[model samples]
Target: MGWVSRLSTVIRTQVNDWVGAVEDPEVRLDQAIADLQMELLQLRQSVAQAIATQKRTERQRGQHQTWAVEWYNRAHLALVKGEEALAREALSQRQSYLTLMAKMDDYLGQQRQVVEQLKGTMRTLEQQIAEARTRRDLFKARARSAEASQRLHTLMAEVGDRVTGGVFDSMEDRVLDLEAQAAALTELSQMQPTVSLTSQDSRETTASVEAELTVMKTRLGQG
Candidate 1:
């Protein structure tokens, strides 16, 4: 029995410790949602930058293509003017622009992919944020309800303790004392009549005895 009691005490202590160590769900959930929101915000910024870079790359690619076309036209004009060396130089410049344009095209393709990936990630993060918000709201409501219930239970327990503790015991003692006093008063009242009757009987007996003594004296002529 003693070991059982010790085990029970240990269990209770451990349970209390666990309860104390547990974080408040409402606070934890709020923090978690805040962190998620921060992550989403940062991701959105990254996505926006990625999109801007993609647009810039596209613009650069377009400019290179335009330059390539201009160089080709110049090359054609130089050939018509019978300037072979100049035409060759213009063709070389056009080839350089075309190479740059090809490189830009490759880079743009990769950039588009990166932008799409970022957009997709943003969408997923947004969904996660939405889910977190919903869960936070739900958990907060549950926490509030649990706290309210706990408060009510505590109040009821306090009331129960008051009713069953020293206050209640003292009231019981007071009632017992009142009853005892009433009983004593009743006993005293009952004894008063008996005392009065005994006194009257003693006086009557004394008077009767004195009268008999006088009669006896008168009968013996000694009065």
Candidate 2:
């Protein structure tokens, strides 16, 4: 009895400890989910920023191309008017615009590359977020299961104590009664009528009556 009581106490203590650990794991899982969500938000912002930068670079490239064309046209008109020095200066201005256009094109290309890279990164981050969410749910479910298992263990330990205290004596009596009833059923099945020579031989005897008298004597002794 002492060993049984000690074992039950140990089980209860272990269950309490495990329940606390399970609760901690659930909390950590939630924190991890929140952290992943924050990371996803940051990735989205980065993707948005990359897109904005790409758009700005594209607009700058277009504006520079237009300016370069306008400069070239002006330079050609001045040359056709025979203003040599003015045409020369206008051509120089046109060359400057062309240089600016080339630089803008290079920058636009870089911006486009950055945007594509950012988009890829965003996709990867989204995938990670999805995986994290799945893991969070799995972890949470495991935590809940662990907690329930711990609770059940604690309950079993308590119930085991109650059984020792005789609090469940009636339940024990009921269970014994059920067992006796099952035994009676088995006895009745053995006594079932059968088309056999041995059964016919016992049918006219007092075998069943003797079996009932024996069971009654045993029951009286036990009481």
Candidate 3:
């Protein structure tokens, strides 16, 4: 049972590895790049929201400062009018605004640092994406070139097989047949005898002379 379990595990691992090997690298690379882009998009949105919050905080802090100044002016005017109690109350209001302003200043400093960090991260991601795109293009070109070479080799292999099985043999046989026909025609022409007008005239003259000799011999015979 333990051996069977180990075998099953090995088979499953091998199957998974085979599946992963068959998966296209280009598709996986594109998907990884897309995921990164999505992450960057989300990060940008986060940065935008953070910046909006930072701006809102800045406005609130500015408003607090304005209120504080206004209160201080009121306090001074009240003192001039000899309203001591009112002046103290106004001064207290100004102090409360000042405290809020101090807290806001601290928060603004922290927010600025955060925004700067986010911007820096966004820049880094952008640069990485650009580099990834360049590498992807290069890899895709190499893959296409490799595919073309493979196809060409496959075609050459098929052609070689055809040549061995039929095409080349048939062509060679046809060429040999044509060469044999040409040689036969040349032999036949060489074997044929050629007669000229001079040969015909000499043969006719010899035949006539033989006939005259035959007639003379017949006449010379004693009758």
Candidate 4:
């Protein structure tokens, strides 16, 4: 059971590591930012719609109020002309317009409030997007740093490589051997005479001729 649990844990860990490697932090951040931007767009649209509705309601309310006043004016004219029945009809029409105007005012208030809430929601989304942009840069830096660290780890992971082939030791020895060989070559070149080896026959012939000239001079002197 313990072994089974350990195997399961290992598999899970391996899967998680694979997932981590495949996941692109930048892509995720960009997607998240895009989603927020879309939400912000939707909220802005909602706010615009709410504002339009409120404005339309307000306009309707104003028109109703104007009609109510007109009806009251008609009632006044009826009273001046002594048409009592006509005056009652005018007042009744005025009351209906006033009732409708009141209802429109209520609707306008609710619509305005909805617009305010949508505006607030849009502001919040904008703020989140701003913060997300900052974090995206930060996370990108972190991802770069993490990749560098992983490469370093991969390069240094072979604990046995140094021992198996004396890799480091061999490298050092090879470098030293090269340096010694170079130094030996330098010394040999410095010790060599600056004479032309290509003219060995000429050098030997000149030396022999000089020796014969000296012998002739000695013989003449003796004679």
Candidate 5:
């Protein structure tokens, strides 16, 4: 019996602790949602950064193309003027610009790929967040229902303990015994209560009765 009582106490305490923890599920779910939102925001920022980089690369490519054209034009003019050294220098500059333009084109292509990947990741995350929201609510509801069930089980345990000869049962028995004793005493008192009241005793009794009547009236009014 001692071991059984101790085990019951432990189980009740653990269930109470678990029910108390149920309130935190909502907080945990919110934190999860917040974390996902932060990730999405960071991903969006990365996408924006990639787009900015792509735009800068495109602008650089366009500038290089323009520079190459200008250099080619200068090279042609120098050749027409019979300036071979100047024509050669202009053609070399134009080749360098064409090389840079080609590299920039490749970089731009890679940047586009990165941007597309970011978009795909963002789409996946959005879908995941939506799914998580649904799951979060379901999880919270289940936690709440489980907590209520645990409380009901605890209450039943307490009632069962009272019914099965625990302290509460003893207390109930003591109350019934006292009630029976009081009934016996009352019957004895009623059998012998025929004494006549003297004038002074009657006056005191009247005063006491009046005071009790006033108190009862006041309580009734308040109620």
Candidate 6:
């Protein structure tokens, strides 16, 4: 039972390794890069919203400052007319603007901090996205190079097998056959028989055959 459990574990490990090999790293890198880009896009939107808040704060501050200036003018006029209560009322109005100024100033300051932080975050995310893109390009190039090298190695292996299986030997044999035929043709071309066999020559050839037959009979007589 222990051995069976160990065998199953080994089999599962091998299957996982095979599956990992089948998965392309280039695709994974691209997906990761895409995810980063999406995050960067969201960050950019956040930065834009932060900037809008900053602008709105600046506009509100400007409007408040104008009211403050107008209220100051009213208080100055009331003092010039010698209306002490009117002067006090005008001063009270200015005090309200002062209180609002303090609050808006603090709120605007916080908003400024937020906007700056968001901008910094956007910058950092942009840099990371750029680095990721560069890494993705480098990895893809390296993968392509590795793939090409693997194909070349595979082709070399096939050639080695063909050489081992005697395909070249067959080609060598064919070349030898062609050379032999060529040599035979050359020999035939060189052979220029000057004399033709006449009827008398044929009779002499027949006599030569008969002489050989008599010699063969004499030699075989001991048997």
Model 1 TM-score, 2 decimals: 0.62
lDDT of 6 by residue, 27-81 (tens): 7878888998898889889889988987887788788878888888888898999
Worst 10 residues of 5 by lDDT: 191-200
Residue-by-residue lDDT tens digits, candidate 2, 74-181 = 878988998888888877887887788788778878878887887787788778778877887887788778778877776776677767776678888999999999
The candidates, ranked best first by TM-score, are 3, 6, 2, 4, 1, 5
* Prediction 2 global C-alpha lDDT: 0.79
Cα lDDT of model 3 by residue, 167-202, tens digit: 677899999999999999998787654446568789
Q: Tell how far residue 158 is off in model 3, in angstroms.
A: 3.0
> What's the number of clashes in each of the models?
0, 0, 0, 0, 0, 0
- Pick the winner on TM-score between candidates 1 and 6: 6
Error at 123, model 1, angstroms: 1.4
* Per-model TM values vs. the true structure: 0.62, 0.67, 0.76, 0.62, 0.57, 0.74
How would the candidate models be sorted by lDDT, starting from the highest? 5, 3, 1, 4, 2, 6
Clashing pairs in 6: none
**What is each predicted model's overall lDDT from 0 to 1?**
0.81, 0.79, 0.83, 0.79, 0.87, 0.78
Model 1: per-residue Cα lDDT over 72-134, one tens digit each: 999999999999899999999999989988888888889889889988988998898899888
Deviating ranges (above 4 Å) for candidate 3: 1-23, 163-166, 190-203, 206-223
Q: Give candidate 4 regions above 4 Å deviation.
A: 1-22, 152-223
When summed lDDT is taken over every stretch of 10 residues in candidate 4, the lowest stretch is: 153-162
Report the C-alpha lDDT of model 4 over 49-161, residue by residue, as the tens digit. 88888888888888899999999999999999999999999999999999998888788778878888888888888989999999898877877776666544444443333
Give stretches of model 1 more than 4 Å off. Answer: 1-23, 161-223
lDDT of 3: 0.83
